[model samples]
Target: MPGSPNVLDLVHRSCTDVAAAHAEHVKIDDAAVSALAAELLQEREDVRAAVRGLPLPIKFSSLEQELTLLALYHLLDFGSGYDPLLTKTSGGRDARETLLFGLIGLHLGGTRMDHHKLKSFTMYDLYTTFNIEATQEVAVMPGVTMTKPGPLQPHAKALLTAINESGAALEEAGAKSPGELLLSLAEGLKKAGRTTAGAFVEELIDSLPGFRDSVLYDGRTLTLHRRAQNLAADLAIVYGGRDDRFAFSDVDQLAADSGATTIAVLRAKGVLQLSEELASTIDEGSELPAGPHERALRAAAVAACDRVVAAAAAQAAGSAEAAGPAAAAAGEEGEESGAAAGAGAAAAGAAAEAGKEGAGTGAGSTGPAPFRAVDVGAFLAFLTEEGRPLHGKITRHVTRDVTGY
Candidate 1:
């Protein structure tokens, strides 16, 4: 609060600091991403009209599902030359978006086709399956343009696996409406296969409103992560947190969960790009090394958390200093009352002086209530690592105190 600009400036410094720190650790690999592109991928008009106009047997049961599907599509909504984490001005989508689309696709459409069935669809065939012909391309969010790549497309192959399965099953069973199919399919899939995509879709559909909400949640989450990483890069430029192990370690301790190792913590924070599973573990996964840019993003995010903690500490210290005089006066008054009861005015004056000395000593010696920046690692955890929001009010406190950018 005292120095809003200084806190905001940390965003820039954290970028440089993190980039230098993770220069040799691991970086983002351009090839790993195959779908959307950047961390926060970006669109929707004609697609919405097309989705509405389609005469599909089983449409989305709820508006939430439809919206989630649309957002997912918009993210995949990429063109040629896609790379995750890249600037919108430079080209297409970035790696994060690509992976997101990949995840959504894999989760819904799946990578494998069902040869046993006469006809099968994946998430990619969004428009065709639905009879929504004539895909329109437009500029989505963040200014990167792409086609109607969402699930509600002309072909509905890889759209929502849940909606597709419900529809397909309903078609086979001669079910009448979309809502009925969703309810029946969701209830019937309880004992479905765990490894198969169809079963996964069934489980998702079974959850209904909550499932769709989760997708929306995931969208907001990934976006926040992307933005946080951008700020992290900015901070790295100012403070070289990654360059020093000690500095990084301080961040790692605050940002990491209990019993997490150095590399594990870094990976969880997205500073080290390993397999998602391995990233949560104590050991690094044997996967493709991350690129420097991605690593720098994580480094910056962590460094930014550390800076927030330091600021909180400083603020608490300042408050304590400001309170010293009031505390001294209170002590003086108490001492004066006690001495007046037992001794003369001369003694009371001496006692008052003693109280001032004690207050000064107490103020000087008492540390700032063991300054614990409870929210220091909250945003990092929310974005990179999986954890609760920062402790108590500090969670929101950082918006004004730590993050102005």
Candidate 2:
């Protein structure tokens, strides 16, 4: 059975179009093509045996056969008998690193088939679908934190949308389904109606033996993801030189920083306008009493400057925390000097100098920038006291506050 029907021959016979597409699009040649064929046969067989050997608690015997049947169908689903599931839509990963990885709660087996799923796949996919049905963590911000959502979560919705879009995209490109379903039961479940949809998804969880044994996927990729050195550079490249951080946990920092910047800019602009108008009033021989607009602008400017200072100091505090005792000791000495981002060139210069000192460690691994400790609570209180009347009013004028990073 290892070579029966000869995997290469099967590729030639059943998956000519897929092979051609790979060569045409991905530029994979003879070796890549043959290697793919062998892997499919070997993995599919291994999966078949695993499912057969599984101590299925319920009447899972039929389910095992049905699941294998799905794998076999997935490979032959595409014209040329190519496995459609093998094609990866995007090279870069997203929350939980793509829908497939997110769904399974694990990355299983070798990555040879990672760019694509082996087939609609064996129990791996089934387990992923099952995992989807349970309450899973939805990444509100990448690498930072996860918010747990109930069944039918946001990630699942995103994944479903992606899949639908993919199918539509392919169809638009002049390919047809050939009436083959990604999952055999999906169509039948549809015909049976939406009421059965809940039950169908729930059934998948009960059928997953791999979950019990914890052998479903590899945990290495999901664990302990730390911030990369070039994170700031990469974010700037993708988002275009914004005062933002893209590390999974930096949404809070981005929000605070953006808020501070916004206040600063708005206040500077408003104060200039008010001061100009007031100066004009004085020159024209009018009274020096400030008008409502002038007062509001004055308050807004103060509030903005305050927020900017607080946010910058907070940024420094974070760096200090990351740098451990040395940063803390160094930061304590520098706190009285106002080491905020408002200091601009000086703070950045310090960070660069630190980089030079840390040169032997690794380029760009110069470690965290210099941080200043700021008492945010006391500063906020002073800010509110100085600009209380119009502070809240000015905040209400913000038209857009994008939270998702």
By TM-score, the best candidate is 1
Deviation of model 2 at 198, angstroms: 42
User: What does candidate 2's lDDT look like per residue over 1-405, in tens digits?
Assistant: 222332112211222232222222112222322332232222322211211111123232332232332322221111110111112222333222233343223323322222133323343353353333324466777686565644334334433433344344334433233122213333344344521212222222222211110011112111000111112112222322221221112211111111222222243233212345544553354433322332232223322322333333334444334445444445556766435423544544444443332111111112332210111111222233335433433321111111111
Tens digits of per-residue lDDT, candidate 1, 45-148, equal 11111112111233544533432333233222222111211223223433334334343443355322221121254443533232222344678878788886
Q: Tell me the whole-model lDDT of each prediction, alpha carbons only.
A: 0.29, 0.27
Give per-residue lDDT, candidate 2, residue 252.
Answer: 15
User: Which ten-residue region of model 1 has the weakest summed lDDT?
Assistant: 395-404
The lDDT, on a scale of 0 to 1, for candidate 1 is: 0.29
Residue-pair clashes, model 2: 7
State how far residue 384 of model 2 sits from its true place (Å): 27
